[model samples]
Target: MHVPDGFINAPVSIAAGAVAAGAIAVSLRGARRELAGGSPTAGFEDNRTAPLGGLVAAFIFAVQMLNFPVAAGTSGHLLGGALAAILVGPYTGVLCVSVVLLMQGVLFADGGLTALGVNITVMGVVTVAVAYGLFRGLLAVLPRSRRSVTVSAFLAALVSVPAAAAAFTLLYALGGTTDVPVGKVLTAMVGVHVLIGLGEAAITALTVGAVIAVRPDLVHGARGIITPLKLRVNGELVDAEAPAPDPVRSGSRRAVWATGLATTLVLAGVVSYYASANPDGLEKVAADQGIDAKADQYEHATADSPLADYGVKDVEDERLAGGLAGAIGVGATVAAGTGVLWVVRRRREDPAAPTHRSAGTAV
Candidate 1:
């Protein structure tokens, strides 16, 4: 959820800011390893990680715009932590959500600038941490199949949404600007978000399954865990082992990247127009519980931005304005996310280090 400016006090906001900063810093370092093809079967080099990470961020941004009705008078959008972590890596997933948050705050005026850190802490760090941890644990216990990966993605996303809600409740207890009872807030937040989590799980599992079907090697979580190819031997079926991963099979991720970007553009620019108009879970909870009493006192720092509120500032056509804003958001998120991931990749990819040949091709 996008916390507003006055929802939290100054001291706790600052502390949350520090926590966000620290998480980003650590993620940046960890991302270097992830982007460098560090996994046993991940043959990816800098190219795959950077472009895929950008696309993943933009996809998350696009999908987040499509808020589906979750309950009576309430809607929910994809939090995207499980999707990103499964597609890329956990560290890069955190950066993906962080990039989306930064874009929404500065350009879209969606999340309050003052609450940027809080949003990142709860949405980025908390969701990714919980989702990735649970996903890996489930994968360890479940059969190593594509279906298992999809199931893990679903379960991880299902848990992450409520976990994030709980984190927000705890933060509110420590630094809420209003006097709402913490127990009520927690119960309501958790209850509503549980329904929202079902939506999140469906989206996460479908997306992960689609990607795995097309390009399993590109999925960070699916790496080294795919069921081996089976061959019919003279008398029985047996595993067919590849002597070595074909470099060409690593192929160019350009096709997949381009396809993903196209899908992102369509979702943001066209599909977002039909998203549920009802207030999202957090907004509904805040309004019903009086938690946003002081939020009206403070204006968003980027309230005057051209793309504020996911609409063009001066565009008369509501559809045209929203469409344009969504397109712009996707482009900006892709650029910013790509830049950040490229930097992470560059820092760890030494000129002297041998190049890695990642497996799988989108075509």
Candidate 2:
């Protein structure tokens, strides 16, 4: 959940900011390895992973705009941590969610500036860490099949939402500005979020399964997991020979990217128009438990932005205004995410870059 200003006290918020900063820094470094395919020969090269990472971030941003109703008076949306971690690597996934949070806070006045670190810690860090861990564990035991990967994605996503909610509850208990009972807050937050997680699971499973069906190579988590089946020849069962490496077809990659971007545009620009208007899970829980009694306004700097609150200011048509804002958000997030990931990928490919052990020795 996006924590608005004043939900957490200044001291705790500042501490969380430090934690978020550290985590982001570490992730940036770790992402280099992930984008490089675990080793020099394990994963997609920089050219492939960089743009794909950006697209993944933009997809998350767009899907988040489509808040599905979870309960009678509350709605929930994709946090994207599980989806990102399953599609991209875990470190890149963290950066993806962080980028979305930053864009939403500064450009859209969605998440509060003061609470940026809190949102990152709970939504970005915790969700990604837990989801990826569970996903890996499941993959370890489950049959190494495409279906297993999809199933793992579903279960990991299903748990991550409530885990994030639980994290928020703990943080509030530590630094909430109000006097609401911690027990009530935790119960309510976790309760509603459980329902939200079901929707998350469905979306994650379908999306992961679809990608695995089409281009499993592009999925970081699915790479090397699904092997070709065996065939019977001359009354003996033998492993099927691996197919010849297809020549790198830039056109195929471009087509996939174009299709994904078009889908993102459709969801954010049009489908979001019909999303549930009710307050989301956190907002409803806060209002019910009085945790939002001391909630403060967002930063004044973004108050007058033309795209504040996910709508274009001064536009007479609500649908047109929201559509424009969503499109703009998608564009900005993709650009920012792509730029960051490109730099990281470039560093990994640099001949002059120091190796991990070498840097450690120098230190």
Best by lDDT: 1
lDDT of each: 0.92, 0.89
Give the per-residue lDDT of model 1 (tens digit) for 188-274.
999999999999999999999999998898999999898788999998999997778556654546778888899999999999999
Q: Which portions of model 1 show Cα errors greater than 4 Å?
A: 39-46, 230-239, 243-252, 349-363
Residue 260 of model 1, lDDT score: 89
What 10-residue stretch in candidate 1 is worst by lDDT?
38-47
Total clashing residue pairs per candidate? Answer: 1, 1
Estimated TM-score for each candidate: 0.92, 0.93
Q: Per-residue lDDT tens digits of candidate 2, residues 93-197?
A: 999999999999899988888889999999999999999999999999999899999999999999999999999988898899999989999899999999999
* CA displacement after TM-score superposition, residue 282 of candidate 1 (Å): 0.8
